[model samples]
Target: MDNQKKQPKPWYKVWWFWILVIIIVLVLGGMMNDSSSSSSSSDRKPKAHKVSPFKRTYKVGQVVNYKGYKFKVNRVKYFSGNSMDTPKSGNQYVICNVTIKNDSHEKQDYNEMDFQLSANGNTTDFGEILTSGNYENNTLDSGSLDKGATVSGNLIGQAKKDAKLKLEYQPSFLDDKTINVNLN
Candidate 1:
């Protein structure tokens, strides 16, 4: 037998395996990014984002179809804010915070939300869409968002006598359509 105790298989011996792993990792990473990028998104404002899914609330199986986006209504809260019908443009939005969580597995790069109100079978009042304008921690992930994590912003228009309402959502994934929800 050779004087040299047969050295255990060295790392270099598995060089091919490492290369294969690296290739697989790269391919997987690329695939994930491509898939996410291809997803349809809204035209809302955008900001720097980090990959972290938060949980909120939504109605079960309640899917709202907007321009083309299918948003699931997680939670609904009513607030009396500035009416979008007002003559003024700025400061008209009293900032009615609507807590929403995305149920679609697809990412929603939400920027602003539009709330519309109509009463007694009147015209649909799609409220003026408002953006949070704050991204320190306003990111809704795909699927159910964890409790406590929320994306809050101002919603134009006030509710008068429990009028019919529709909420619009803009995702932060891709540019495509808005997610509209009918809140009656």
Candidate 2:
């Protein structure tokens, strides 16, 4: 009997090997095609952004409805502090008596910081001066409000005594929309 060893089949000639090679080639080709298409599309100009409509400005004593909340500036009072609690030179305490109501179905947050006082080209944030007499113990507090709950208090700021003022409300940082209340 001849003792010649049988030659092993070449890897390229194996059926399973060819099948795997074909699958790899197909996958690579598909990936290259997808990358080329995406690169071409990236050269196109982006779509224009839609502009938002203008909102109406609310006057003092008018209820402003925004983002499921109701805001009203009842009145604005000026105070020339007594000898013990006077404002800075050429400035006086400007107090805004306001009411906020949560009209949404869920709880909402209320903060004095949400209100800003703008006057004479300057903007002032909500704050309290211990010397300013606490505005009659009715300063607006920061807290969470339940649905339909209401809170009323004073937002105090220091500004020129004769400057026309406006109150701005922007409770959410994610939202750029602001409600302006003219407090001349």
lDDT of each: 0.44, 0.84
Per-residue lDDT over 77-135 for candidate 2, one digit per residue giving the tens place of the 0 to 100 score: 88878877778899888889999999999999888988899887688886855354667
TM-score of each: 0.27, 0.67
Residue 170, candidate 1: alpha-carbon lDDT: 40
Highest TM-score, which number?
2
Error of 1 at 34 (Å): 33
lDDT of 1 by residue, 1-184 (tens): 6687876788767778799989999999999988776663432445566422222222324644332333354444443333333423222222333445444455444434233333334433334443433321333323334333335433444445445454544444364343444555
- Estimate the Cα RMSD of every predicted model relative to the unseen true structure: 17.6, 7.9
